[model samples]
Every structure is written in C-alpha cells, then in structure tokens.
Target: MNLYFPASSDKKTVFSAIEKYISDQQFIIVNKDENRPWGGFYVIDEAQAGFFIETWFKNVYDPLPRLQEMVSPKILVVAPGKRLSWQYHHRRSERWKVIGGYAGVVQSFTDDETEIKNYHEGDVIRLQKGERHRLVGLDAWGIIAEIWEHTDSNNPSNEDDIIRLQDDFGR
Candidate 1:
C-alpha cells in the first residue's frame, strides 16, 4: 500500500502520523517483482528537507524498518548552466522526475557514445545499473526529485559506487 502526502500538508501533523503508524507496526512495504514494470511501493515520509521511502525487495521476506541511510530520496536543484558529473554507478540505480524548470539529460551505456534528452516539468528519467548519466540545468534553475536505490542489497555502499568519467566540479 502506498500513501502520498500532498505538498500543502502540515509537516508536524504528517510526521506525527507517520511516527504513530510506524510505532504501531501498521506501516509495511510490500515488494513485487521487477518484471511488474514499475518498482515496489514504499511507505514514504516527507519533511521540509525532503522525503524518503521505505521499500523492500521481493526476495527479502522480512521488511526493514527503514531504508538504508545512504539511500537518499531528495530534491536536487541544479542552477542554470550547471551540470553534474558524467558518472555511472556500480551498485545503485536512480530515477529522476523533473518537478520544475527544464533539464537536459545525457546518458549512455558506454563512454564513447551518449544521448541527450530534454525534459520539462513532470517528465521522468530512469537510469539503470551501469548506465552513465549526467544532468544539466537549462534556461533556468531545474528542480528534480531523485529516488536513489541500491541495486546490490548485499553490498550497499557509496564508497566506490560512483565512477565519474567527467566532472566539472573536479570531484
């Protein structure tokens, strides 16, 4: 079961409700197969800073009380003319939804070839494991909701997950 809190909802009220529901063990995340087209549902909790979803894998029978700390589901705001590094992940996959402004996503499987796509608000971009991708803000500031998940559950670490082929920020 999935619960969504609107952007206008009160933070204190939502947080208290989530805390109460969790303590009562009423909130649980059910996992379905990846073949289902979309990912499994999550018990999402929102705050002013951002939001995080608690999701479980279909192979795992027991649900974790919370998601991994390194797994961050947050809003990314990229300033105009700025771009993230051209990088790939070894153990993680990310789905990005453009919420505001415009974005240009350059992604590819190999370092030699890349494809760029323009995205407007409400557009979604999915990056699978080992896919090199980069996000660029265009025209104005771009805001995107990034749902980051670990592909390898057994080894969930960001120590070497990111392989940056090119970076403008110099690391």
Candidate 2:
C-alpha cells in the first residue's frame, strides 16, 4: 500500500490520505487537533491504551503552564492488546504518536464498518470529524504526551456527540 500525493497544506487531504493508508492496513485513527499554535496526532490501541507523544511549546522558556492549559500534558500508558470502545465527538480532533511498544489501531465508520492497522513507536496518526475510532495494543505500551484543546478534550458538558457503536462497558 504505497501511495503518495504532493506536499499538501490541505488538512482534509492530509487526513484523507493518512486515513486511506491506515484503512488499507486495517487500522483505526483516533485523533486530530489543529486549534493549537501547533498540530497534534493522537492514537489508541485495541487494549484501550493511547499514544499521543511528542512535546511542543518547547519554544517557550517556561512551558509547564502553557502545556497544562491545554492538558496536563503528560504521557499516556496502556497495556498490550487492549482496545477502546467506538465513539464519536462533536468537537476536537486528537493526535497520537507511538512512543513505545506495538499497536493495532481500529478506525470505524458511521455505519459500524471498521478496519485494523498497526503502528509502532515513532509512528503518528490523527482522527477527524465525528470519526468513530479506537486502538488495540499489540504489546505493552505508553504514549509520551497528549495535547488537545483545553476547552474541548474531555469536557463532559460538551460530550453529547458520544455515540458508541460497540461497547464492552455498555456505553
């Protein structure tokens, strides 16, 4: 599955291409974030473990609060072979980077169709507009960091778009 497109600033095309690649390999993309001064790619695995690594705002001399403002901005760890439930969001995309271990990511469609793909440390991925997705860890893993819109990442008040396609928790 080797496909390429010219350098693109088009976010939709960028995402679409990445989506196609992951899909072709049967993987899921879980997050996409653009509201920041920088961008992010967040992913998760079948064991419900997440990977959203890389640090930003390092440009700032003192970046602690800057990061915490968006999120406490810390590493995410998950056990191997775990997966998260299928769900969607009304706002905020997520970005993930595999920092350690291997993963099988699962991206889902509105109608419940899904594909599985794999990623390893140093790999990056993203999710977009109401895309139902999740991840499965192929091996014990941990994500270095997760940065998202402070107001949108996990605000329960705004989580009305959570439509679980399949759930182990009966979500």
Candidate 3:
C-alpha cells in the first residue's frame, strides 16, 4: 500500500510506479472493513505491465468525443444530502444541467479560494478543465445531466486525468 517516490518525481515516474503496483485485474487481495469506505488496502504484488497503453489511453482519452458526436452526456442521480468528490479533470470540461431537485455546487481555484452556489431545476453550471468542483444533492435527491467534452490538447494521452483532491467515498 505504500511506495516511495522521490521528491523530484515527475508525473510519468509516479504513474510508472502505480502501473507496476496495480496492473493485474485481480493482483491484490483485500479484506472487508465495514468502517472504511474503501474497505482498506491489503497487499500489493509486482505485476506485469500488460495494459499500460490501454490504461494510459483510458486515463487520458477515453472520454474524448467520437467523430460526429456533439457531446458525451451522462445522467447522475445523487442521493439526498450526498456530494461528489472534490475533484478536477485535466482533459475535459463539463456543464451540469440541474434536471431535478436542488444542487449545491462548490468550486475552488486555490486551497484558500472557494465558492458555493445553489441551483434549482433547469439551472446550469459550467466547469472548466482543472477547476476543482463538487456537486451536492440538497434536501431531496438530485438529478443532473452532465455534458462534457475533451479539452484541446496536443498529446491528449498523458494518463493523469481526474485528480481527486478529496473524495467522500474514499476512492
């Protein structure tokens, strides 16, 4: 569960270490821990780098819109009083249409900067790439239609995409 990265480690270096540690589909065994949302980290084995290219592609470009597609859309049903992780994506931007119920949208730039906004049905909010954001269901269950598109990028496959600064589900 623990690996050391040098202070000067770059993104590729850190990613390589993670790749080496978690490659196999069933490489590790974990025991159930009801108290921890993630169960808990148990054991790790060195695994063959069988799917690096595929993993890298998914990590970076899987969400890119297909040719002739206008936008990739998804519907999220958030339970009452629940919230998404505080996270940011490097490769995509999103627009959230509050289709039902109330939504509390929280966003931030720096650690010291934050804004919380409330939206009701038919309201919309835009999130730019790399902007930390979270959506909370208020009072009742909430429904959102999330429309997103890939950001302009030269490589578009650098492998570091959704960076969760904080996660309620411990993921």
Candidate 4:
C-alpha cells in the first residue's frame, strides 16, 4: 500500500499519517526541494533510486534474462489547486492512475496540439516519451499511482531527467 498526503499538509501531518498508515520498513522518504510547493511522493520501490543488484546485473550483462520491466512506482498526492510543472522526459514514459479525489490533466503530443481533461478515481493516463504533460489538483487532494517506464534500457531515467517547459512555481 502507498501513502498520500495533501500538498498543504505540514511535515507533522504527513508524518502522523505515515506512522498510522505505513510501516517503517515499507518506504523511504525522498523529498526534493522543487516538489515542496506541490506534494510529496511515497516511493514504494527504493531500488530505483540508487545502486541496486538488479540494475547492476542488467548493466553488466546487456540483455539479461527476461526480467520484469524496470519501473519506479510511487504514490503522488497533489494539494487542491496545486499543479506540477509542464514537463517531459527523453528516456522514460509514464502511466498515471488516479486513485483518489479528482484531477485535471494536460497533455500535448506535439508543439501545436494540446489537450486538457478531467480525471477521477480509476482513470488512467498514459504519457509517451517526449510528451508534455502536467497534473493539477482539483477540489480535493489528488492521489495518483505513477509508474515510470524506462524506455532506454541502457540509460534509465531519473528525477533529473525532467525537462520543464512551463512551471507555476518557477522551478
């Protein structure tokens, strides 16, 4: 299970919720400065962040046994009215599933074509590499399960891969 908290929630609130809902060994907090204004993520897969046995073996032996896809999964909690930067990645794609509350999504396949839509619980959105996208919190906290799909096996994408075109927080 993943934990979710509103963006406006203070550290105490988040910690309290985590203590009540998540076990100490379940996840590790990896908060970033840029994400402070929005919401935080409870990363379920710690191996995706740093050196791991699976990644090492894959890197050493090109095309290892058919292993499960390398994915970084997390639960995103966007505060009401807060929005993430309009960004895209070159080495990864993403699949987002709205799990709680409502959300507004903006996606663009090309420079000239853009689409905005509202999503609710159980709705899923798929974003391909180089596709510009942003998620906005609606009336309540928006909880989403995000799965980062590493497109380039040789060079997987990480937090630094974000290429922001527009941002509300001047990120």
> How do the residues 25-65 of candidate 3 rate in per-residue lDDT, one tens digit apiece?
33342221122221112222213112322322233345444
TM-score of each: 0.59, 0.50, 0.55, 0.71
Off by over 4 Å in 1: 1-71
Ranking by TM-score: 4, 1, 3, 2
Question: Could you give candidate 2's per-residue lDDT for residues 1-171 as a string of tens digits?
Answer: 322222232445544554565455444445544222212233433232211222322332233323333332333433344455666666655555564455666776575656778876666666665777766644443233333333354552133655667765455
Candidate achieving higher lDDT, 3 or 4: 4
Worst 10 residues of 4 by lDDT: 49-58
What's the TM for model 2?
0.50
Count of clashing residue pairs in every prediction: 0, 31, 0, 0
Highest TM-score scorer: 4
Q: lDDT for each of the candidates?
A: 0.57, 0.46, 0.53, 0.67
Model 2: weakest 10-residue lDDT segment is 45-54
Better of 2 and 3 by lDDT: 3
Candidate 3 clashes between residue pairs 3 or more apart in a chain or in different chains: none
lDDT of 4 by residue, 8-97 (tens): 556556545643443343445454222557766666555543322232222332443223666675667777788889988999988777
lDDT of 1 by residue, 124-152 (tens): 78788899898886655555656666776
